[model samples]
Target: MPSDYHHGVRVIEILDGVRPIRTVETGVVGVVGTAPDADPEVFPLDEAVLIIGSRTKAAKLDTTGNGQGTLPGVMDAIFDQIAPLIVVVRVEDVEDENEQISKILGTVDATGHHSGLQALLTAKTSLGIKPRILGAPGFSHHQPVADELGIKAEHLRAFAYVDSPATTVEEAVVHRNLFGNKRVMIMWPAFKVWDTPLADYVYQPASARALGMRAKLDNDIGWHKTISNIVINGVSGLTADVSWELQNPVTDAGYLNANEITTMVVQDGFRFWGSRTCSGDPMFAFESAVRTGDVLADTIGEAHMWAVDKPMSPTLIQNIMDGVNSKFRELKNFSYIVNAECYLDPELNSVESLASGKLWLNYDYSPVPPLEQLGFRAKLTNKYLVELLEVK
Candidate 1:
């Protein structure tokens, strides 16, 4: 019998490539709240982690009417306003409200248990995703929850959209005074959502809606655009109608603004009418500036990941600087930033530091500030009479 023989050969190709800096994904929101038992079909609920991709999946996991129903409502609000990617972290259900709050605050030991807010803090390790925006929706009103989220956002280089615990404008002003973190944006006076089953408009935290609006803003315009003055779509109405006059500095809204709290008002529609962070520092007062800085830091960090193990040399430093400068040039061209530059100072990056395998990079960028105020001057003049005489 004749035997058939075959010869096998394999080819391998190696390509040298430099990974260019990329803009991190914006508008991805990380939500931590309570959910019913996990549906194996939708997501591994038992794992207490889910990255919802569609409104249908969100509806399936909707816990809108449960005791802790506001979580689903927040999710629905986000979906209604804008279709941003949502990462849901479902906490363990406990009967006691106090115990639940403690669990969410991460006060209780999470060993062999599903930690609530702690889950979100460790989402990158557990779920393989990092959200640019973080919120607890219904829970953000709680001081502890808001504080924890603010700390997380600051540490993770993200933004925290929080709601004031105040039910009235007056209370919101007081609550706003308690916060002063650039990473946090406190929204006041929840909006009314029409409940289908109850056939009534129920008040819900505006943080969810604000996050959705910010996501929409980032998607529609660049991230540097101010989130204020935009219509908050998919809301029946604000819980309370705040007048434009009252929003002035001498009024409640003004005080709230001083404390870094944003409020919505009834205009042509329910509009997000403020844009400032809780940071007491005037340098980072504007939310857009804070956000732009965060985006730049994240983008630069990601871009330089490849330089970690490479030998530290002048060429390596120049290459890194060139890449970052290129990105900043694009951003400046897009008007996202006024100007930006990257360089290494000889004093900062000394021979000792280079010998020790340490490199120093100086990055400076002027973010486009929001036009929060405008002034007009009027004068009566007779120039029109001269022009008319000349014409005659």
Candidate 2:
């Protein structure tokens, strides 16, 4: 959703689309020097916990040359109205500068104030209030500030509204607590493979080793012979017998870049979406293809593609290949293209993307340290090269 937290209230409302529904009752507490003419009680205070910081010293907002008393008394009325979820947002006036001015005016320059609210909300959350803090522009800092305030970052979902900006803390609380039950799930696949007594920690699986070996042998002979043969035959002309040096085993987190995956597939005559790349789940490939054209349906949710990061036995690889192929058959015209970089140990001589010939296996790369920092040698011999390509 587009957000306008950087600007004024009117801009916030204009940019932030519809108003979210406030399902939780929370006391909106804050110390603001200035307040809008509208009463806070008239706002959404019924089920909310409301607390106002009384200014013993005439609030700066009230003493300005053209100032009309806007806050203190209004706070009294708001406190009397709707009882709500309780938390405190303390406002302390720093020196009289633009910083102080913005703070007094509720212009989003209040990190401390926001932090205070996050703390208060967090306390409420601890008590099971599930408080959500919504803030404009500067308030987005709430994420880290909340952390500093000993509050859980996820507990306070921050948002920006450019148009019809929240006039008071109460309004801000309303927007924050109301983001529909819209939750986003981000997925990534772990694609690492190892062999022999679990040689690679990142991709360790005795089962995978057994499975991969079986699959490799079966593939070499004939399982999914049609596709395998086609792929082998088509690229056989470009195959080379050159020995290439492979290096740098990938760590647990490091993997191929998203763009690299897309390019690899497109080059292999497959179409894919950058956003559709799933990390560990192969089913997402089919789901991504199905939702390709449906805008609403395609709003990806709880779906992704990922690589299993264990030493794959030939049988495991075969299972993966078969599973994907079956889904591809159902989807029709779908070609499997993994967007992540294939992992190779440093002991492996080299990777060759040949234009023709048989895939020659020479050196075993499993024995070398996977860490790139251990000082691995780089080889220029070209078996296969990574190329930058356009996303289809």
Best by lDDT: 1
lDDT (Cα) of model 2: 0.25
Q: What is the C-alpha lDDT profile of model 2 across 1-392, one tens digit per residue?
A: 34645554443242211112211221222222332222443221112233333332223223333323323332222222222222323333355545533443332235533333333343444344433222211222223321222122123431111111233323333433322211111111211322222333232111111112212322243111111101110111111111112232242112222211111111242111122222244332222221221211211111112323434344443444444334333333222212212122434433343223212222111111112234757888655544434336
lDDT of each: 0.76, 0.25
140-201 in candidate 1: lDDT tens per residue?
Answer: 88888999989878877888899888767788878878888898888987888876656677
Model 1 is weakest, by summed lDDT over 10 consecutive residues, at: 43-52
lDDT of 2 at 357: 24
Error of 1 at 254 (Å): 3.9
- lDDT score, residue 100, model 2? 38
